[model samples]
Target: MSATQTRTGSCLCEANKFTVKGDPMLFVVCHCMNCKKQTGTAFMSNVMFKEENVDITGCQDVGQYADSNNKSGSTILRHFCNKCGSTMFGKPDETRKTGVVYIPSVLIDGSDAWTPTKEVFAEKKCSFVKELVINSPQ
Candidate 1:
């Protein structure tokens, strides 16, 4: 895809939609307990991008929670579709100043194209979940 390429996706109910531009900064698989609980899975995949590259429509249908129960110890603004309770993305407290946003890869259109560059909280990874091997973007 071109550097200016754009991707679009929406919540399960289509109550909230988003368009993101350019390639993602990082693609990560998180194994934190908070992530597992939030996604109802053993792990969660996230795609990171510069905050300015994303645009959301139907803001009124989105809900946010100040998540402070994670290992980070910082509050993360977790955005979800209020209508369907579909998790959308997370904006960490630092993101407000650094301008970075992480969205659930499952919520991205054509998500099959996503490749994980790294994994976080591996110590918390479930025993049955195999390790992910991916080429380093370095």
Candidate 2:
């Protein structure tokens, strides 16, 4: 773990808040159809941390929506703020070795470290968006 172990974030309406301890496992920009539709953007950037390292508060205002199963049969859980409808994160159904916690870049405070390590579903990326030169899962 890095010397800086804590990071903070809040929902657009300030109704949901959370703190994440430890450094992120990985960062990614997803260009899948589900992410594009959910975020209304070319892609969605997420920072992955360990679930145990995250402390969440004000979850009563959090809302969850899941997209249809993907080709890999993984269910994607989209978490957002019900009060202001700000999308906050995506949680995959698959259990990760580190117990992943995915947080959206827009809701993160320490965004300086949010540089994406890879892109996913690059084939689905918008034509208007320039191709990102990063490792991709295809």
Candidate 3:
């Protein structure tokens, strides 16, 4: 994808909106227990991008929680909308890029433009979801 491509997204209530000015650096699906609990789903579709390349707005009621029990052991700030209780994004301190921000793939403006190459924390994935996927990528 070109670095110039732009993407925009918002929370369920549209109270927290944002724009990614450039292409994402990485995309993945996480089946970790914490991720599933946070999203209330079987897995989390996460997208990574340079923080400087993304823009945000309409966050008057946004809130965050410091998550420290993650795989990296480094503290991650989980940001979300306070009003709608939507999982918006996260900031990872020990990942490959410290300046990169983690966004939910559902927030991306389009579907065909983004694809998660791999899934993580498969060991913790639910049994019911295990029989669904094949030949995962990275």
Which one is best on TM-score? Answer: 1
Give the RMSD in angstroms, all C-alphas superposed, for model 2: 3.3
Candidate 2 lDDT for residue 25: 74
Model 1 alpha-carbon drift over 4 Å, by segment:
94-96
Consecutive 10-residue window with the lowest summed lDDT within model 2: 89-98
**How close is every model to the real structure, measured as TM-score?**
0.93, 0.85, 0.86
What's the distance in Å from true for residue 117, model 3? 1.3
Q: In candidate 2, what are the lDDT values of residues 24-95, reduced to their tens digit? A: 778788888777777788888878877777777646688788664666566677798888988886677554
Mind giving the per-residue lDDT tens digits that candidate 1 earns over 1-138? 666999998889887889888878999999999888888899989989998889875456887888998787888888888889889988877644568888998788877776899999999999999969754897
lDDT of 3: 0.80
Give the number of the best model, judged by lDDT: 1
The whole-model lDDT of each prediction reads 0.85, 0.76, 0.80
Point out the higher-scoring one by TM-score: 1 or 2: 1
Off by over 4 Å in 3: 93-97, 131-138
Tally clashing residue pairs in candidate 3: 1
Which ten residues in a row are the worst by lDDT in model 3? 129-138
Summed backbone clashes in each candidate are 0, 0, 1
